[model samples]
Target: MARVEELLGDELLEAIRGRAAGYDEANSFCHEDLAELQAAGYLKMFVPAEWGGSGYRLQDASRAQLRLATAAPATALAVNMHLVWTGVARVLQARGDQSLEFVLREAGQGEIFGFGVSEAGNDQMLLDSRTVAAPQEGGGYSFTGTKVFTSLSPAWTRLGVFGRDDTGAGPQLVWAFINRQAPGYTIKDDWDTLGMRASQSCTTVLEGVAADPDRVFRKLPVGPNPDALIFGIFATFEVLLASVYAGIGQRAVELAVDAAQRRMSLKTGRSYAQDPDIRRHVAGAALAMDGLYPQLESIARDVDDLADHGSFWFAKLAGVKIRATETARQVVELALRTAGGSAYFRGSELERLYRDVLAGLYHPSDDESAHATIATAWLGPPED
Candidate 1:
């Protein structure tokens, strides 16, 4: 029920949008924006009201993120990792699972959570991991492996990490939280990229970093299975991720429309908005973006309502993420064309968005994986 505009306000978003270009130019983290958001209680948006949080639902959070991304995609993305964890905890609790209650409580207390799921060459995603989760003598586990794209690497106090424990029978996947201050882990300062630079999604190398007893959570068997935690994560992550890119697409179309209305045609001596070709291009981008909002809303609403779509859930989630991201890329390209050479300038917002939207392709459930997942959902598994 909470409105994002009230929580973020026009002034705050304007400041974030102003900083986005500078942060990208310097290849720095959105520390200032994070500070403001933390102060605004944005960090605890998903935490329960009883725990001193806003208690916003997944739909509210998704919509807020979509708006935030329009102002600053990288900041929205940097903060999204934290949102994902808190949202996951919220999802788990909504389903009557109290296992992640501490996550909600801590987030409410102002502790930031970071995403640590991505790894190099581990396309199995949640189903498998290359990180070694060796069980400790008394309890807990020591994780040893490299996790790439650890977003919010600098600001997060707790990082949700997972790994494969071969020491156990048949190799089980160990999910746990690693303290940022934990020993034997290195946060590499190597986040320079084409876009989304403010995220500071650096590489994290864990050399036997310890996860204390109680921190070691799920221990599911390798490969996909029916686990609520997995479902919760997939639902939250994909939806929020989609929302952020959808914001980018929306912003791009807005910029295109503005450019069309403001620029004049020398031959016709009229605004480009009156030009049929320009109007069609802007409309095409707007039309693509128009299709995304309902899909995102429906998906978020389903996650909130816990609608039992059964096996179709994964396909639907993956489809929306791919669609939102791919559509964003298309809309940005269209905007770049409509805005003409001015948009190609280094400091232009459209230019930055053009770069930022490309990062969507690298996220989980990539084109190949998503298409395969969708195909399997409808056509069954491939022939041997």
Candidate 2:
């Protein structure tokens, strides 16, 4: 069989490059387009075969996401979150101790799974969530709390929420696949943000909702069984997120090069593309992008190795997240500056790319945690 990258390369690239502008205009992807993604079988790449999915590998999944992000950051950001969540959900479902098959099928079928993990004044951890999951009569629980910055909430069929059990131990994750047509959950529709505006990230409220125990992926104090297996899973997710931003950066450079080729400097009566300054800027941007490719390739290779050998996965995961995070930021910024003030305008592709690339910094790594993880790993055992 062809490698996953070989399978998804051209198609993923075409999808992103073709639809990026429309996604920007819509400020989020429409349901019909999302359904098309499902129909294309792209939505179920991470889903297991038993769930009527291709059971594709994670590396293939990462390459596909990277391709999508390159076309439209918001679409990539919103959909990538669902893809990673689906991957994680499949792992939990495999336990059979926590059967989330019904919802998994929905997610596999391209149902939006808006992440409701970020909370006010709380770091992005399950324990920090204010959403409460209380025991209900019979066997379910009632959930009440607000989540902020959820991507694609306006179009989501379900939301994957993490909160604490009022009486139980540790953190509890609940998959609340509420009806978007219902009033049980309200989308604030107030996600006016500085970056990734097309993501349609909005606040969410879940009230008086009944959740079955079986729907709960795993209780807090989760055993090492799934957690250990999931470490590599999350590592791959980080790679996917960063890769999308890198694609955005790549698009930024492309836009700048295209513009430079057409622009002329009045003073010298020469195409801007021929000017030494423009050449230097574009060269630098390409170099940065080139640097990203090898690193991304290495990350894909390393992740595959970890899955095969299961060693040093956590540390390597942190390193790739950090590298992709910083490089994407630099590459996009270079593209913006190279394009000059015109790139700041609404019509400028670089403007959208600028906003989209910034989203990577706020992803799981966030510099601080990524650095800490690397530092802690480096300082292991205090050197004896």
Candidate 3:
């Protein structure tokens, strides 16, 4: 299996970086970057080799995402949505569930999958859904609800969505996939944001859109449970999300180093790199990044190896996300301070990174949710 770095060469990254600013300025999707990545077969990184993909393990895929993010955080983030679904399929496959095998096969056939699970104000994070899934005449369901932050909106061929089905024995959460051309579904062009502008993560409105019987993959009771599907989604989503932020921090540190070296001090007749304070700031950011790298890689590897962490898995996954996001924020702040006023410019990479990292706080398992999850795991559930 070829390494991800090898697959995405330096030339490709430079090309992606060259176009990132233009896309951000226009607040559009990274079409050119996606085309290059698609040509390189990046979307199929997690698919099995027999399916004509590189068959990269989760750890390797996360590393590739980190590298990609360093060049263009928005591009990496947009692409991460596709990776999340494919990563979820890989996770399910490892656990002996072939329910999502078609996802892999579809990728091999040039299908692009987009995540459509995030609903506006639905903070329960997959435990609940604002969308309604009404049963059809024969089988399958018609989902009716709006999903926010639908990345790859302009290019996705398939969208993975979930909703509530009250017609069941109880209100069960229905998970399914719908084609982009499915009836009664619309992709709203309302993705203008503070950061990650190039992602084009617009709003997805589903109004009685039908999901084929074969496409309705899972139906489980609401709230926290031990379902493999839930675990797969949580684990893959958190890990990949963290990798992107970590990559942003990594880029910030690199920029900081470069700035410190080139910035000369008139009073001392030397560069900022020779100053103890500047050195300390860069070292601090590097230290924080060093801490996250191991956790990201280790947890991803554990998922790849299917190591059983039981109930602890959720806490660990959430922990890595929180750590990576918070650490990246701090690193970016330090980088900004180290780089001085120049980094505050609109076109500065650090300026973009600062905004991109903030998006991490809005992902599933936010700091508050993650802390509650950890506290509950360590001390049992709160009093009812």
Stretches off by above 4 angstroms in model 1 are none
Question: Candidate 3, residue 101: CA error in Å?
Answer: 0.4
Candidate 1 residue 300 C-alpha distance from true site, Å: 0.6
Model 3, 204-317: lDDT tens digits are: 999899999999999999998788899999999999999999999999999999999999999999999999999999999999999999999999999999898877889999
Each candidate: how many clashes? Answer: 0, 1, 0
lDDT of 2 by residue, 1-384 (tens): 334555455665566557666667666544544655666667677676676676765566766776666666777777776776676655455444245566558765556666676777665443345677777666566678887878777666666665556475554544344445545667787877766766677888777665556555544542233353245346657777777777776777787798788788899998989988888888888888787777777766555444443434556676777777678778777777667788888857787777767677777766877676567667653343
Ranking by lDDT: 1, 3, 2
Q: Which candidate is the best by lDDT?
A: 1
The Cα RMSD of model 2 versus the native structure comes to 4.0
Off by over 4 Å in 2: 1-19, 22-29, 90-104, 108-110, 166-183, 222-226, 229-233, 308-312, 380-384
- As for lDDT, the candidate ahead, 1 or 2, is 1
Q: Distance from true position, residue 47, model 1, in Å?
A: 0.4
lDDT comparing candidate 3 with the true structure? 0.92
RMSD of each: 0.8, 4.0, 0.9
Q: Which residue pairs in model 1 clash with each other?
A: none
